[model samples]
Target chain A: GAGVSQSPSNKVTEKGKDVELRCDPISGHTALYWYRQRLGQGLEFLIYFQGNSAPDKSGLPSDRFSAERTGESVSTLTIQRTQQEDSAVYLCASSSSMNTGELFFGEGSRLTVL
Target chain B: AQSVTQLDSQVPVFEEAPVELRCNYSSSVSVYLFWYVQYPNQGLQLLLKYLSGSTLVKGINGFEAEFNKSQTSFHLRKPSVHISDTAEYFCAVMLTGGGNKLTFGTGTQLKVEL
Candidate 1:
């Protein structure tokens, strides 16, 4: 792909419903990340994947938030029993390598919990 | 631990005028600083970064920033502004020897008017 791609650009769901956000990173990129941006809030790191090593999940806010990545490619973030406070923009980004300082980001998926 | 702070939440300036967005970061070790711009309805795009060598770093769209180690700041500046430059700016820091996750500031909204 020319750039990072995210699916379901906008999502609306009732509270307690589970939502899945998908991210397809740039071709051949070796690193992928997930972040959340609440309204008027800073970008919050969620998880990171580098090659086949263990992902950095320390940033996950709660047990309800979980993410999975397939190698260095597609990544999915799932929020179970979503809360109204979970309404925010979910962003995905990728870099060529872990050491690279710059990142390429997706348009982001806006989740609106009702 | 590493953190970034964008001093101003919003800045409005007339077109052709110069503008500066202040940013300060706290880190205990070597770090990389970066500025990212997010246009309305779009993903974040890298503006510039200071990794190593030369404190002044230039980036696309005529944006530049200087890394000041003494004050632990990486403020963004532009000699001239345009209406098209209106966007949300984020300052971020990544520890060179730690995980690849970036810590981002709350962001500054730059509004350029005529």
Candidate 2:
């Protein structure tokens, strides 16, 4: 794709249900990132991946929240036992490399856990 | 650890008037600065970035920002704002070589009105 792409632009689920958000980074980009944005709030870093380096899980809020990226391609963020507080927009971004400061972003997936 | 701060939650400016959105960051090591804009129902796009060269950086839509190391601030400015300029602006910081994790601020809502 010309830019980062995300699936399930909007998702609505009941509390305690599980949800998965997908992100497909720009082709050939070696770095990918996931972030969460609450209503009217700033973005919160969730995870990051660069090449073959160990994925950064430091930003994951809890064990219920886990993400996996296959090589330099598609990535999935799964929220298990979702809570109402999990309601927010999940954004995905990709950069050419870890050294590059500019990031291309996806439209984002909005999750509403009721 | 690095963090960003956006003091103004919202800034209302009249059309064609000048506007400024303040951003501050704290980091133990050298860092890169960036500004991103999010339009309604859209994804975030990079406005500008400061790496190593000049302190003044110009971005799209006639927007610019200055990186002030002394004050740890990267303030976004526009000489004249249009109604289309109304959007949410975010400031972010990335570690030069630490882990490539980008930390973002709460964001500033710029409301350009008539």
- Give the chain B TM-score achieved by candidate 2: 0.98
Tens-digit lDDT track of model 2 for B4-44: 99999999999999999999999998999999999998889
Model 1 lDDT tens row, B58-80: 99989899999999999999999
Scored against the native two-chain complex, candidate 2 gets a DockQ of: 0.80
The global Cα lDDT (0 to 1) of model 1 is: 0.93
lDDT, candidate 1, A1-114, per-residue tens: 599999999999999999999999998988899999999999999999988989999999999999998887799999999999999999999998644668899999999999
Model 2: CAPRI class:
high
Candidate 2 structure quality by residue, lDDT tens digits, A8-88: 999999999999999999999999999999997899999999999999989899999999999999999999999999999
Runs in model 2 lying further than 4 Å from the true structure: none
In model 1 chain A, which range of ten residues has the least summed lDDT? A94-103
